[model samples]
Target: MPLHILDRLNHPLWPAARAIYERSFPPHGRKPEALLRRMLERGQAYVFVLANEDSQARLHPAAAMALAGPGGSGLIVDYLAVDPALRGQGLGSRLLDELERWALERTTASALVIETEAGAGKENEGRRVFWERAGFVAPDGHVHRYIWVPEPYAAMYRPLPGREGGLLPPPSGRQLFRWIEGFHARAYRGFREEE
Candidate 1:
């Protein structure tokens, strides 16, 4: 049977969501389940589950994407993940489409924005291709540095009509640095500092 997508936060099958994420990104270096719970608690995140229509049991999450409220002028894609088993099955694209439709339903948002690593490594290259295929364009003049790594990363934005410049303002170096610091603090909260 085909899967149906639902928006139940307390769905019985929610626990498996983390396992699916772990399988896809084993070396992700962070626990996604904890973060997902936090996001959901904040009410800024949504979980879309793909399940069998007959029994409503989750087969697997075809795709999962979270959107934070409008930062400067647009919405930010806080996180996006798809089950590895469902990759390349058009589920990712469908999830993105639903996200856009969601944004359009909001009266205040004008565009959607997301950040991703830049350049040509296996992971980075694949991410770039996916965003490009989803209609995201890398802005010509913006670069944000990674907190853990010294290298800088590019920013990408997808302008929605009337919200072209409504998204978060481009970050300055000082601002970016602060962001990096915050990211590291949260991402490694319980880990001991290197001696």
Candidate 2:
């Protein structure tokens, strides 16, 4: 499988990739496809897919991921999902590896940051574990609750590869939060944080 950076929204495999994205996250957790299109058009965000090309040159997309930044100190993994039938095959980790390489080569992001649900009883522990295995770290006892979403979320980060392919220390929780907040303020204008 090869990782594809989606520069045009109308690519042949776009619908399939978008389907994977829509089904992966709940309505409250995802940005509208329209917004995504606008961001793509304006180069405000990036979308990636892992796919296979068959003999006739058609693409079969297996996973999709969207990202929001290297802006204001954060590179947010806004959404990521593998096809439901393709779970446990390490496609997600492959995608992350490709993404990290791409970011390292093309951008100067401090780290790759993501938000995972942290509320009790939310069945998100496995999700957190997956991130941990991919080298993301979150501070213990810290959760950010948004007003528009009921579940509390913890921000986790994997430091980008530093000079000579070494890993830098992860960014602080405050820096991670700022990156997420700055991106969301522009991308999710009406949403606010819980006081």
Candidate 3:
């Protein structure tokens, strides 16, 4: 499997990757396609599609992920989804692993962070478990609420390995929240938050 960084709408994998992204999240939970395009064009994000080669060596998208930051703040897992037909095959984990490597080798991010729904529900619980299995842990206190997102979310992070393979310390919850907020500010520049 290979991870393709799709930074343009004309990329060969864009259609499949976009379809998978649209189907994975509800409209309110996802950025509009136009905004996503702007993010790519501005180099504000890293959008990746995990692909596998077919018999003829043609690559087909299996999963998609996008992230921002790691530009001194931290790397946030903006969105990650395995194709509906390919769910339960551990492709999500594989993609995430590749993402971590990319971050480690390519940036100065101190940690890899994610936001999962905070309420009580099986879906939320399952998401938490999946991230936890990947070594992400929630901060001791705080359910971060964003002005634009209706659902309350909890922040989780796995500190990246530092120089000489030493582990970086986890960031404080306040710092993590700030990094998340900064990402939203940049990604949603023209949109206003509800009061």
Q: Quick one: best lDDT, which candidate?
A: 3
> Model 1, residue 151: what's the lDDT?
51
Q: Write the per-residue lDDT of candidate 2 for residues 143-182, one digit (tens) a residue.
A: 7888877778888887776632332344556667778887
For model 3, the stretches where C-alpha displacement exceeds 4 angstroms are: 55-60, 67-72, 163-169, 191-195
Tens digits of lDDT, candidate 3, 1-195? 688887777888878887788888998888777777777787878688887676623444545555454433567888998777778988888887887888888877767888789888999999999999988888767887777677888888877766323324546666677787777678778743441
Question: After superposition, which runs of candidate 2 have C-alpha atoms over 4 Å from their true positions?
Answer: 54-60, 163-170, 189-195
Using alpha carbons, what is the TM-score of model 3? 0.87
Candidate 2 overall lDDT versus native: 0.73
Which pairs of residues collide in candidate 2? none
CA lDDT for candidate 1? 0.55
Per-residue error (Å), model 1, residue 42: 2.6
lDDT of 2 at 133: 100
lDDT of 1 by residue, 1-195 (tens): 232322444666565655555565545543455554554565544554443344323464334433343444445655566666657877666666666667777546565566677655898889888988988776564667655656567656566755555545744434433443454344445544331
Best by TM-score: 3
Error of 2 at 25 (Å): 1.3
Segments of candidate 1 deviating more than 4 angstroms = 1-9, 26-32, 50-58, 61-69, 149-151, 165-195
**Comparing candidate 1 with candidate 2, which one achieves the higher lDDT?**
2
Local lDDT at 57 for model 1: 39
